[model samples]
Target: MLQVRVKPGIEDRIRGFFPWVYRAEIASLSRKPKKGELVVVRDFGGKFLGYGYINPDVSIAIRILSFDKEEPVTPELIKKRIREAYDYRKRLYINSNAFRLIHSEGDLLPGLIVDVYGEYAVLEFTTYGMNRFREVVLEALVETLRPKGIYEKANLTAQKVEGIKVREGPVYGEVPDEIVIWEHDLKYLINIPEGQKTGFFLDQRNARKFVRSLVEPGDRCLDVFCHTGGFALNMKKMGADEVIAVDISEPALEVGRKNEELNGLSGIEWVQANAFDYLRELDRRGEKFDVVVIDPPSFAKNKHAVPNALRGYKELCVRGLRITRQGGYLAIFSCSFHITEQHLLEVLTQASYDVRRQVRVIAKTFQDKDHPWILQMPNTLYLKGIWVEVV
Candidate 1:
């Protein structure tokens, strides 16, 4: 293994179990390192800090895998970590079989993601370092979960950043283009080959179930950026007479319609249009709904885009607030780490003041328990939502 030492101050954070070392923070290295090479990180005084894999090409140069000196970064370690993550998920006892088994840094396995949908397992390697353990990871998943098939979804952004070359297809056994997976009492069709974010937004599973409590029979509801109608179907299942689901992807909407039929439910209008434009048109038509949910894609990919992201969020909040009837409920979600819960509150406050609607927060929700987030790495806790009652 290569040996590298960081600047004096950087050691404190690494010692605190914060598992990233920026390139500029390095003071010295025994030799030039190759990308995805295992390296032992040390402090300025030559005291060991942690063991991690180094990526010389990226700003996030090193993602520490194990802080313990005894536990090194080995193929065996990857197998062990996968099993540990599986045990943790089993403990969660998620109502649905589809869940995030490994949450990157949250599971202490940086740059790896594993999501299980029924008899299949979907894998994504977000970092070049973790990609080195791909074979072991697949073997571990087979030994642990014993899924009928394993599929790899190529993340374009990760490809560009980390230079991981993986074709999007089944790597083990056979995976179908579509599969029906049930969450709570509703069934959904997941398009693994061409769907967004591993074919479905499983992170919002809890929020989808929670929204049912606010919906009443014959109530009208709106789902903006509602990929595959996760929230819309739940609203209808709760006896809402009318539900409208809007998304930009025609394929996703098609699946959403199929999901509506899969559950023997009806009256959910699936529309394919830009969510922002649709929301503006709804406000123009003076349409008011009893409940509304705006779950948009990540507006901010990185920190530089947060200002514009806030503007987008504020616009959604404004439209969501204006069209919600008095005493009705509205929920706004941000799925990016760059947009914090505080940012959501600030934007919602500004939007409410602009629309002249005083609101009180009724509830707040986050990614379900299966997607565990480490307090040391705030980025792991990416998805957050705020529910407010319009007055």
Candidate 2:
């Protein structure tokens, strides 16, 4: 394998078990390896460090595959990582048919995501290295788990960053047009063939369950960005009096409405419109509700756009407060990794102050157990949500 030398202080960071090697950390390279090539990582003094996957184009130049200097990045190593990640889910009692199996760097497998829905598992290979191991990983999962279906959903911008086109459908077994899965005793119709992010936001499973618990009998709820009605269906099951589900995509709304029926539910108010525009219009008309949910998509992808994202979140919160009855509840969230907990809280605080409403946080939540957060990595805990009661 080609050997790469790191700068003086960077070797310590790499030795300290940081999984990423930035291009700036490298002082010199003993060999020019191709993108996604397996390379030997070494210290500035030529001492062996570890093995990693190298990509010349990305700032995260090398994603460490093994920290052991002698260990090879083999299929066995991949299997071990997969089993370790699966064991964590098993320990958490999240044997649910639908859950995130691998969360990129969180699972020590950078640029890869796996979501298991019952007998079917969807694999998203985002990075060049992970993409290269797609077949091996799929074979290992099928062999070890005996899953009925193993499909691929590499339709993410991260794949584009690696100069890879989104490849959807079955890598093995049969691919379904709409994959159905269960969460918290709720049935959801997920179109992995057409839906977003492995077909649904399984990361918000626990938070939606929390929402279900908050609903009282005969209470009216509004779910904004109610894609596939995950939150809407939960509210319905909890016996909410009425639910107004809104989304920009008519197709998503159709699937969501079907999910409602799949769960044997009715009396949902479904509207297809721009969420921001709809919220603002509702605020202007002085329409109010007992409960409201704001679970918008990530407004900012990187740090540079966090300010704008915060502004957008603040506006959403303010409008949500405007359309909420006094002593009512609003579940607000931001999925952007660039937005910190402190930042989100501060934005909410400012929104409450501007609206002159007293808001108290009833609860705080992150992604479910399926998405593990590494101690040294805060990015894994990207989704921040708060149950705010307007007073």
Candidate 3:
């Protein structure tokens, strides 16, 4: 195996169990290894540190695979990690089979995500190392969970950044054209082969349930950017009077409508249109709603775009507030890691000011427990939700 020699001070971080060994931290390398090749990491004094996967191009040069020198990076290790991850999920008391099983670095398995939807498992690999472990990891899941189907949903950009090519489609079990699953007492369908991030946002499960708790019978609810109708289906199940789910993608809206039916919710109205434009039109028409949900995609993938993303988010909140009835509730969210909780709250405050409305925060929430956040890593807590009452 190739050897990666760390700088004088680099041993401190690696010894402290820090997962990433950036390129700058390395003083030298004995030999150039293939991307994702397992390498022995050592300090400048030639003291053993650990084993890890190397990627020559990225700043995050190597991701430590194991701390124990004896622990082989074998299929058995993958099975053990998979087992531990599953056990942790079951402990959460979330009976739904549709949830995140492994949340990449959060689960101590960086660059990999495993979402379980009933009998199927959707795996997304975000790094070359995880991609190299694909077969072993899939075998682990199959042997441990005995899932009916498993699929791969590789992140093209992440792969590209790691100097690797994208590999699409099933890597193990047979992946059908459409996969059905249940969440928050509602049924939904997904096409992992072409669907966004395994065809649904299972991470939003808890937030949708929280929104449902605020719903009342005879209440008219509007769900903006209602990807696959998560909030809409939850509200419908909560016995809302009516539901309007809007999204830009016709195919996503179709999936949302199908999910509404799958959940036995026939009262939902699906609208295919841009959420921002729809909200503006509603404002112009003097339309009002008892409850409104604004859950848009990540507007700021890069830190530099945070400013514009905040502006966009504020505008959505402003429109949502304008169309909300007096004393109505607004469930707002920001999935962008760049948009900190404080920043989102400030944006919402400005939005309230724009509508000349006084709003009181009812509740605040972070990402669901399924997407575990490492205490030292604030980035893990990306999703933020705040319930506000327009007074």
Candidate 4:
């Protein structure tokens, strides 16, 4: 393998298992390394640091996979990591068959994501280096899950940045367009070929269940960006008399409708409109709800977008706080790593000040146990929700 050396002081983070080696950190290379090629990473003085794949063209040039000298990147090692990830998930007692089986760096397999739904598994390769192990990943997934089918999803940003080909669709066996999965007494229809983030937001499983605690029977509730009715249906299950689910995607709303009926639920008003617009309209109409959930998609894809994302989140928080009835509950979430929990709290404080409503934080929830995050990699803890009670 080609050996690569890092600049002085750069090896400290790598030794601390930071995983990523930036292009500017490299001091010398044994040869002109090809993109997506396995290489040995070393300290400035030639001591071995770790084993990783090199992507010479990108800013984050290398993603270290194995820190052990004996554990090089191999098919067997990949399979072992997959098995270990599975074992960890098994111990999670996630209360649902649908979950994230492999969380990339969290599972020590950067650039790879695997989500299991019923008997089907969805895979996404977000790095060129990891894409090279597709065959091994698929083989391991099949051998471990023995699922009826497997599907592949594309990460468009990764494709462009890592120079990997984007191939989305069924990769193995027979995968139906939709599959049904259960979560905490609720059944949802997952559109594997079309839904967002591997057919469902499994990371929000705990948050969805947690929302039920603040709901009371016959209460009025609003679910913004309520894709597939995860929150809306749960509100109804909690005996909320009136529930409104809003989303811009007509297709997602259609699935939300199906999910409602699948759970023998009725009376959830599914609205096909932009959540921002709908929230404003609700405010204009003097609407008040006992509970409100504003779970928007990632508003910031990169650090450069954080300012605009915070603006968007602040607007949502303002509207969410206004529409929530006195003594009621409101929950706001950010799925972007760039939007920290502190950002949400800061935005909420400003929103509350502007709206003149005193608020008390009720709870804070994060990605479920199945989607474990590395402490060193804050980005791995990408999802955060803040639940508050309006006073």
Candidate-wise lDDT, in order: 0.94, 0.85, 0.85, 0.94
- What's the TM-score of each model vs. the native? 0.99, 0.96, 0.93, 0.99
The candidate 4 region of ten consecutive residues with least summed lDDT is: 371-380
To one decimal, what is the Cα RMSD in angstroms of model 2 from the true structure?
A: 1.6
- Which pairs clash in model 2? none
Tens-digit lDDT string for candidate 2 (1-391): 8888988888877777778888888878776778888888889899988888888888888888788866788878888889888888878875357888888888888878899887888888778877778777987788766887788876567666776666877887786777788887888888877888788899898888889778888888999999989888888888899899999989999999898889899999999999999999999999988889999999998989988988898999899988989988998888887888888789889999999999999999899978877666677688989889998
Distance from true location, Cα of 222 in model 3, Å: 0.8
In terms of lDDT, the poorest run of 10 residues in model 3 is 163-172
- Candidate 3 accuracy as TM-score: 0.93
- Candidate 3 residue lDDT tens string, 1-391: 8898999988987788777899888888998678898888999999989888889889988988687889856667767888899999989977477889999878878888899878888888888887888878888899877888888776878866985566777777687889887665667898787678777887787888888778898899999999888888888888888899999888888888788777777889999998888999999999999899999899999899998998898888899999999989998888887888888789889888877999999998878899998765677789998889989
Q: Once superposed on the true structure, which residue ranges of model 1 sit more than 4 Å away at CA?
A: none
lDDT of 4: 0.94
Local lDDT at 220 for model 3 = 92
Which 10-residue window in model 2 sums to the lowest lDDT?
A: 155-164
Per-residue lDDT value at 96 in model 4: 92
Deviating ranges (above 4 Å) for candidate 3: 8-16, 42-50, 68-72
Q: Could you tell me the TM-score of candidate 1?
A: 0.99
After TM-score superposition, the amount by which residue 161's alpha carbon in candidate 2 deviates from its true location, in angstroms, is: 1.7
